[model samples]
Target: MIPLLVCDDSAMARKQLIRALPAEWPVSITQATQGEEALAAIRQGLGRVVLLDLTMPVMDGYQVLAQLRAEGLSCKVVVVSGDVQEEAMRRVQELGALGFIKKPAPAEEVRATLQRLGLLDLEPPLAPTAPRPELALKVNFRDALREVSNVAMGRAAALLAQVLGTFVRLPIPQVNIFEVSELHMALLDAQRGQRLSAVCQGFIGDAIAGEALLLFHDLEIGAIANLLGWQPQNETETSEMLLDLASILTGACLSGIAEQIDVRFSQGHPQLLGQHSAIEQLIRLNRERWKNTLAVEISYSLEGHAVHFDLLLLFTEDSLSRLTKKIYYLMEQE
Candidate 1:
């Protein structure tokens, strides 16, 4: 039997890829959570076909592909990522990926790719089996939230791109419900080893209220200002530039989400939490103030620029009941 490997930081993504495989394909599957592990597994002759994800900690899929090329390893690689920007696709292909599949891939697309690669024989498609009702509902709800986040993020990205006069690359927004204390863990990539500058804006409406935070690495401020066509000569000028950028992004994102959920938000003024502060310490100060929260994290990177930042929307636990209802209603409308 041929060995096939799935490499992604997300367990959910790996499971989806497994489920998407042809039922009769004669292959043993292996999983790796990062690029280094995936490389090691491939070197050990563990996989002839690899499913890869692009964004990961420690090492990313691009680095893995570079290493594979350098070692003259021959393996069929298909990139599976939520970073669907054209540049990303072209980069992976240049690095020798056999093909690209965007994230939240439909099972049919996966099967088609395998068949096209001559890895799977063309066979009649399997009859769809109905999922358990509860499981189906859960999946629908999650997908709905993701869809909403995707739309809102695009709207925000568009505005930012317009302001900076550059294309903005957006990752798939990550949505989760967790205790307030666990918030810091979810932001490991964004806050890793960087003193962050953050701004917070609160919004409230009938039965729903939340906060939106914009986080930037302190070192990136100068590049960000230059991108915005500003030359800040003083600390105050730099601070103002940061606040302006944060306001534009946060307002557009929050407003877009609010419009979709059919709620009008009364937004508060944006407040700088502190400059050069640890993300954990900033959140810890408010730890007792919040319980569980539904967090939507969006990371934006500028194409051809060194500026990258994170936008985190935090909805309070009490607001989730209404938020879920709104999402369900939006799903129905779709």
Candidate 2:
């Protein structure tokens, strides 16, 4: 069996890839949770062909590729990542990746990609077989949710990046089950008393329900407008710019997550929650409606621009049971 390394920060993501591989392919699989480990394994001949995730801690797949190329290491690499932006795909190809596959990679797509890369021989399925039990267990709920949100955010970031003509820096998603107090404190501390603006929109479908908040730093609005080659000459134009950004980000992000779980969220109209307002006031306004919440936070930045945005997917307390049920089957089945 050939040695294959699956490197990803999320255990759920790693297993999904493992299960998606051509069932009859001849390979002894090893796993790495971060890029440094992946590099060490590759150097030790543990990964002749690698399936690598782009977003990870300590090091990323892109860094690993650069290191390998710098040292003149020879190995076939296929990037399996959630960042499907044209820029991301182009960069990895230039960095020596054999091919690219988007997240929740389907079995058929995996087969075709591998075949095209000459990594898999054309063969027929002999029988329906189960993946190893170790790879089939239910992953930790928090990690699973973060993985889902990670993939979801990648799509959103790609879209936003395309519109703005900038590369979006994706942070590791933060997942929390927070009491109302904890939520307030968390947001306040993260904001550091900076003046901010936000767009609030609610969504629901089937048993899943949540609200998405897109928070923008007040001072960065002008910089963002400049990126689009426009200068806001009046209050209305400035507000229009902010609203347009909020709409694209909020809609694309919510749609990404909804697509992952096979649910269609009917999103309510977005409203300006506040303009040049303190986050504390925003939290106070929201406190009455939140008791316990599932908060998934993603911080996005641009590669060479002074622009940042925080997107929060806040699932209400009542939505917990149904959301958990949805996530339970999501990772297990994938």
Candidate 3:
């Protein structure tokens, strides 16, 4: 049985990867929290495969790759980063990695990769984690972050319904916390073009609120304009209006959530963009630092006709602190 090494700074990511692996593979798996720990693991034994994430606090994956190459270590490496840029991909290939797995790679795909590498004989069906017990969540901080999205998203939808003058129905948005690379890829689907436009604003309340985002397609701009009762025009003017519309929606949506969650946050004006390669670029421009991340996907109809596709909110870690306080306050009141 080939030995397998899983290295990532995030505990959540590590658990997800473990669950995705073939259950019957006789391979003994080892863990590393960061690049230094990975080096220590290598000293312990020569593993056949090392699944690594790119970003970390003490040392990054790229640096680890450089050190390993310099020392002439030759373990088969599989990158499991959220970043899938052309340059990033090229760099990893240059660093002697065997392959890449986009974050949240389907369980089947993870199994297939191991088989192709001759690491596994058979694959097992992927099973989701069971819901945690209520008492467990009450004491756990991470679970509270997940629930924040559920409560906030519900309030945001109600606000959307009122603003659009129509009933807006939406499922409770699922929260998937990830590194910037993974978060960026999920938010910016490849099917969409390279050129992207967005509206961004900040919110401040009991806890810090990073801002909400409304990302959209240029071609779909006309559809949105029609829904809003505006005539479409040339590209320049149309682009401006789209940004404004996004700003209004994002502001109202986030504010509504804040009020319901028992937090008061002040929001800034929306910024317009003609081209943004990564959403993190926008975050950098805004000078926002977040401790946590919460993403809420929103889909609602405009006037019972055209449906607008927008992400309601993406909260940062610090902003998430506010959510935690609010939840406990509400729970105490209950």
Best by TM-score: 2
Q: What's the true lDDT of residue 139 in model 1?
A: 32
- Candidate lDDT scores, in order, read 0.78, 0.86, 0.61
Candidate 1 TM-score versus the reference: 0.62
TM-score of each: 0.62, 0.94, 0.49
Total residue pair clashes for candidate 2: 0
Model 3 steric clash pairs: 82-182, 204-265, 204-266, 205-264, 208-319, 291-317, 291-318, 292-317
Best by lDDT: 2
> Could you tell me the lDDT of residue 51 within candidate 1?
92
Worst 10 residues of 2 by lDDT: 121-130
Q: What tens-digit string does per-residue lDDT give for candidate 1 at 148-220? A: 6765676677778778877787776788887865886776567777878888888899788888888988888
- Sorting all predicted structures by TM-score, with the top scorer first, yields 2, 1, 3
RMSD in angstroms, candidate 2?
2.1
What are the per-model numbers of colliding residue pairs? 0, 0, 8
lDDT of 1: 0.78
Model 2 C-alpha lDDT per residue in residues 1-334, reported as the tens digit of each score: 6788999999999888888887778777889999999999999999989999999999998999999999888789999998878899999999999999999899999999999988875234344456655475458989999999998899899989988999998889999998999998887766767777877888998877878888888888888988888899987787778778878888888888888888899989877777655456666776766788899999999999888998899998888888888888887687
Candidate structures ordered by lDDT, highest first: 2, 1, 3
